[model samples]
Target: LPSAGSSRFAAAVTQHAPAFKGTAVVNGEFKELSLDDFKGKYLVLFFYPLDFTFVCPTEIVAFSNKANEFRDVNCEVVAVSVDSHFSHLAWINTPRKSGGLGKMNIPVLSDLTKQISRDYGVLLEGPGIALR
Candidate 1:
């Protein structure tokens, strides 16, 4: 992957994906994940502003519901948010009726420090939030 500061990235609309590493909630457990973990596999990664909000749960569940389809094509679906791991766990534990993304099969990473959002160039500096 090209470095975030590389000229290629500056000139190209779609540069190499930024690298990230952090803790994530997976099947009710916390796990560590990094870009390297998906080195040999195709990944469908999504970054949402936060959890338990309007539209976010729907998107998360949508991707999660079709997890099998991605696996069939050798791809892994992963999500990231600025919320903490604890928040992720709670949301997943809650049911869809409560507007929570319950029991997702994919990894939902926490970018509590916002480093991942910054590296991905999706961080809204002024608001200290990530744009989906």
Candidate 2:
């Protein structure tokens, strides 16, 4: 048995690190993905507020620019938000010239149910979104 606090903490960790199941934007396609997909690789899982927003693109682009660095270290960056795969693709298709992500090598996951956001403890409950 565990203390109330300890139990809550364990539950929280289990939720985030558990087997994640969803479709990810990969190589210009939305396909099924899960934590097991990254089992043999170092993963830099990050969460952002949403797509097409200020401050978010800055971080996304910055990560994009350094994507090779992570890859060099044998690590893959997987960014997530409460947006749909279509939204992620749209943002990727839009050009930086028009305030959108352009040609990013990393995959952006869609957590439309907000389950991932909540599990990661990055969700802005007030607005029912993530905080980035």
Candidate 3:
């Protein structure tokens, strides 16, 4: 993973995904998670721009609402952003009508260091956030 402000970025995730481990908010609880946790299953790893946003919430909640469907097919859904875990929890606690992520069924991770975003080729290096 790229260090903070590292120049090595935007190389694209051409090979296997760069492994990552970090704090995540899952079902309104904090947990330690890593890419390895979803082993033996199809992993839908998605990266968003921030915790509190307009379009971002829709995508997060849509995937979250459809989490069971993914699980039925033996897959796991995980969302990542450059925001802190606290922010993710707060968003989950908020209602969807208010533009919060609301009751996330999938795990939402905190990429405060932005390493995951960087490794995935979604990091906006200038602003230090994910692209999608």
List, in order, the clash count of every candidate structure.
Answer: 0, 0, 1
Which 10-residue span in candidate 2 carries the lowest summed lDDT? 1-10
lDDT of each: 0.85, 0.79, 0.85
Give the per-residue Cα lDDT of candidate 2 at 37: 85
**lDDT per residue as tens, model 2, 76-123:** 898899999999999999999898988888888999987767665577
Ranked by lDDT, top first: 3, 1, 2
Per residue, candidate 1 scores C-alpha lDDT tens digits across 1-132 of: 557743223213566567778999988999999989998888887889988897899988999999999999999999988999999999999999988887898999999998887777677778777778
Instruction: For candidate 3, write residues 50-77 as lDDT tens digits.
Output: 8778889988889989999999999999
RMSD of each: 2.9, 3.8, 3.3
**In candidate 2, which residue pairs clash?**
none
lDDT for predicted candidate 2 compared with the true structure:
0.79
* Model 3 spans > 4 angstroms off: 1-14
Q: How high is the lDDT of residue 126 in model 3? A: 93
TM-score of each: 0.88, 0.84, 0.88
